[model samples]
Target: MIGSGPGGALTAWSLAKDGHSVTLIEAGPRLRRPDFGQSIGHMLASYFWDGGARTSRGNVVFPTMQVRALGGGTVFNSAICMRPLESALERWRDEHGLTEMTSEMLDPHFDAVETFLNIKAADDDILGRRNELFREACSELGWEWEHIKRFEEGCVGSGECITGCRAGAKNSLDKRGVAEVVQAGGRVYTSVHIDQLIVEHGRVRGAVGMTVDPETYERRHPVRIHAGCTIVSAGAIGTPTILRRSGLTRPAVGSALRFHPSCYIIGVFDEEVNPWFGATQGIHATEHLEKGIKLEALWATASTFSRTLPKRPKQFKRYLKRWPNMAVWDGWVSGDASVGDVRVLPGGRPDIRWQMGDADLRRLQETNALLCEMYAAVGAKEVFTGIVGLPDVMDPREAADRLREGRFERTEMPTASNHVFGGSPMGTDEERAVCDGWGQVYGIDDLYICDTGLYPSSPGVNPQLTAMALAHRLGQELPERY
Candidate 1:
């Protein structure tokens, strides 16, 4: 195991439980309560990569956020556990030649993961004021929405989903996969960085990397180790970087990066609607998927809310005055047209180049405009859309016109994605993809990649469930000869 995230930890646990020796290496240490402070800067230093890592193309830098600590992004993510929609699975099978993705093949794995992780519906009591307002607004507009499925077991609703859970109720593989692997005699090494894969005669031999000294902050230079098989679970970005550094070049090394670009709608109400008292990603509108949009409620801290307020001093004052009456909602684009690339940089850092296209940009604008209208329908005194060149509360006619006529280019769009896909992608043809249906690298023996990178395309939903399902299926099919 070359990473300690959900994919890596789960892979190690599965292999070790099957009576295999495994050594899990993590570049960062296990995140503790002190490391997950209220300060974003402190949290970034401890869990994130240099205030959030970025990939550059020419002069424009595209920012991507990933958790570098143990448990990976799940440590700081809102615990929204949704399986990939059936429509997406059918599309993969009918259109993408992924015939094995049928429900018959997937349901058993889903059941296993859900049972192991304890997936359930979010409690309505913990649904914050924003959720109440959102439901009311959706009802008024005759829109269909659903409460989110969460992976938390007895969540106390501290509303600190972005920060590492102090309650330890969030089941993001740390308490499940990591615990199982460790208990089964597998070793997990923290603060270890892998530099390259050791490939010998078209087979994965092992890997070499360094272990870091926490107190001195110095690396001991990664030591080499041999294994019969090597699985690349370092995530979409990390896995591709490792492969590229090791001189493994396939046509689809780092291509087809898709991100569900999202924007927030801030609604100012008359009554206190503290959104920070519930699941961060609970309550979403999936009805708009056919229309290329999805709406969801979000919880944010005061600092994050303050940062998103208008820059003008007067606007800032107004925002603070109505802080207690504010609620945040999310709008996500559904089209799979945008493209981003992940490449290895000069200093061995992973570089990403992401930008949206005209159609996708237009859809995002439309979605944000619709959210603003929905907020107004729900008796919001004022609606704030984070889109440029649009009024805070434009009328329906004005909103439509502004959204359609907006000249904002793809590069000008505000974008950031925690959900990443492609790179070592899976497809029928080896020439078009790095991995096959079994997640085996086309040309290498004893080398498998069981992670989000195997996603053929963005499923327009949380990738964790699909990732785990695929990993389970792959593990079940591991070659006996190995």
Candidate 2:
């Protein structure tokens, strides 16, 4: 395993339990409870790639977040466990030639994963004002909404899922799957960076790289590992870059990248929300999912929140004063229309290029409009649209109208995507996809990809659950095949 996020950790655990000798290598440290920071700035520097400042280049400079840790994004995400939508699986089957990628084939694995991770819906008791307000708005609008299902066992509702769960309630892979892998006699190496694969006679032998100090990031001892079979679960960006650096120059190696292209709006109300005290993201609406939109309640620390504020110091300060009475609601477009690619730069850095298609941008505009309506339904006094051309603050109806009717370009919107997919997609056509139906690299022997990078198209929902399901299925087959 070349990475130890959800895919990596879960796969490694499965292999280890099956009595396979597993070696899990992680680029980031095995952060303990104390190491998980409270503030967003501290957590980003510690857990995220590029201190959470990494962005794609092209038509729009959109931000992307990737985690670098033993448990990967499972440690930092809100633990939203959404099954792959049947419609998306159908698309994969019809358009991508992934005939077996259906709910019937994958639901058992999803069930096992949910059972192991203790995934369940968040209780109403912990759905603080922010989440409650979202639920109320959804009810008022008669849109279908539900409590977010999560891997929280003893959650205290600190609303710190993005930073890290300090209460030890979150079932992050580092605390669960990775730990089980170790107990089952798997070897785990932390802070090890794999530059490229060791290809011998057109087959992967293993990988080569160096270990670095977790905090200083100073290069340390040279490291190399030889394995009978190598699985790269290094996330959507990391996996493709490693494949490219290894001289796997097939066109499909880093092609067809995709994202959820998400943004959030703030609703300032008259009552105190204390947004930072509840489950990080506890309620979500899927009414517009057919249109590629998913809405949810969002919260972050004050410092992170301040970054989304207006540039005008006066207006910024004014918003800061209303923090206690504000709630953040966010939405994401499936990004089926958008496309991107990852290329390895001279020094092994990833150069990501992407462009948001006009169709997806319009979907985002509709998403913003829906969010405005939701806030308005709940009687928000004012809203911050965060679109460049729109006023920083406006009445809910005016914001909704501007969002619905405005002639907006992709560049005018501030969007980011925590959920990214593609690059080393799995498909029947070797000419288009880097991996095959079983996640085996098309032309490479004993090498596989088990990550979001293997997704041929958007899964149309939060992807962690589906990513794990794929990895779990791959794990079951690899031991038998190899």
Question: How many clashes (backbone N, Cα, C below 3 Å) per candidate?
Answer: 3, 0
Q: Which regions of candidate 2 fall more than 4 Å away from where they truly are? A: none
| lDDT (Cα, tens digit) per residue for candidate 1, span 1-482 | 78877678777776777777788888777766555566765676556765565444532234567877777778888877778877777777776677888888889888877777788877788777777778777888888988888778878777787877777788877667887888889988878888889998988898888887643436886588788888888888888889888888665877666667777767778888876777776788877876667788887677776666677889788777777788888787754777766788898878777666677777877777677777777777776665555664444445545665677755555655677777777777667678877778877888888778887776667777788777766656664646
Pairs with backbone N, CA or C atoms under 3 Å apart (clashes), candidate 1: 55-352, 209-222, 210-222
> Where does candidate 1 have its weakest 10-residue lDDT segment?
53-62
lDDT of each: 0.74, 0.90
Off by over 4 Å in 1: 53-61, 213-218, 392-401, 404-407, 479-481
In candidate 1, how many Å is residue 168 off? Answer: 1.7
lDDT of 2 at 312: 94
TM-score of each: 0.93, 0.98
lDDT (tens digit, per residue) of candidate 2 on 1-482? 99998889988987898888999999999988888777777888777899889999989989999998889999999999999788999999999899999888999989989998999999999989999999999999999998999998988899998888889999999998999899999999999999899999989999999998998777898998999999999999999999999999889999999999998898889999998888999999988887789999997467776666677999889889889998999999999889999998888899999988999999999999999999999999998887888987789889999899888988899899999889999899989999887789988799999989888998889999888888788888887887
Per-candidate alpha-carbon RMSD to the true structure: 2.3, 1.0
